[model samples]
Target: MPRFTDAFRVAEESGQTMAEYGVVLALVTLAVLAALTMLGANVSSALTGVANLLP
Candidate 1:
């Protein structure tokens, strides 16, 4: 029926949107982790430097 078809279309669109959001979230998470990994060494050095500066 027409109602059933409309429901199916809506569901399909929602599923696509969900998939897109999931991909974006995964990419963002990966980017954040990569940034942290890259920055961790610098951060550790900075902390060490700060500690050395202390008494």
Candidate 2:
């Protein structure tokens, strides 16, 4: 029936959309992790400097 075919099509499209969202989320997570790793040492030093100035 037409309704059955439509339901299948919708499910397939939904799956594709979910896959795309998952890929984007993975890429964004990787980017954030890379940024933190690259900045970790500088951020630590900056915090230490501020702490030293306080006490």
Candidate 3:
């Protein structure tokens, strides 16, 4: 009984920690996506400028 309770607590903690990590990863992914979206047009324009200058 005591061992089972201990195991349950550890499992619950692990699950909670994993959930927290997943949330952090999701937030970071969203931030990166937003940054790329905001910069995409500028980057495209810059590339076009460079291409026009090349040939």
Candidate 4:
């Protein structure tokens, strides 16, 4: 009985850790998306400037 309880506890902890990892991954993804969005316009304009300078 004790062994079964211990197994269950460990499983629960593992599940919780996975959930935390999922949340962190989601947050990181959002941050990357936001950074890309903010930088996208600047990058586009820079490229356009370079293109204009080209023959």
Candidate 5:
């Protein structure tokens, strides 16, 4: 009855929240990976330059 519907609603809300969190986490992970991929070569080259200069 009323109590059962309330319990169900709470569960549905919690599940929705979990889905939102998962989507956000996935987006953040993608952004970070893309940034690293784009910058990886540049960073490596810079480090090599620094190393060459040190010696």
Candidate 6:
């Protein structure tokens, strides 16, 4: 009984940790996407400017 309880606790902890990691990964991905979105227009303009400067 004690061994079973320990196993269950370990499984629960592992699941919780996995969930936390997933959330963090999702948040980081969203932040990166947001940063790219905000900078997209500026990046486009910079590229256009560079292209214009080329012969």
lDDT of 4 by residue, 1-55 (tens): 3676666555347778899999999999999999999999999999999999999
Is candidate 1 or 3 superior in lDDT?
Answer: 1
Q: Which stretches of candidate 5 lie over 4 Å from their true place?
A: 1-11, 51-55
- lDDT of model 6, residue 34: 100
Q: Select the stronger candidate by TM-score from 1 and 3.
A: 3
Instruction: Quote model 4's TM-score.
Output: 0.59
TM-score of each: 0.59, 0.69, 0.62, 0.59, 0.61, 0.60
| Best by the TM-score measure | 2
Candidate 3 versus truth, CA RMSD in Å, comes to 4.1
Which model, 4 or 5, shows the larger TM-score? 5
Each model's number of backbone clashes?
A: 0, 0, 0, 0, 0, 0
Q: What does candidate 2's lDDT look like per residue over 1-55, in tens digits?
A: 4676666555457778899999999999999999999999999999999999995
Local accuracy of candidate 6 as per-residue lDDT tens digits, 1-55: 3676666555447778899999999999999999999999999999999999999
**Worst 10-residue stretch by lDDT in candidate 2?**
3-12
**Segments in model 4 whose C-alpha atoms lie over 4 Å from true places:** 1-11, 47-55
Candidate achieving higher lDDT, 3 or 6: 6
User: Each candidate: what lDDT?
Assistant: 0.90, 0.90, 0.89, 0.89, 0.89, 0.90
Give candidate 4's root-mean-square deviation (CA, Å): 4.0
Candidate 6 global TM-score:
0.60
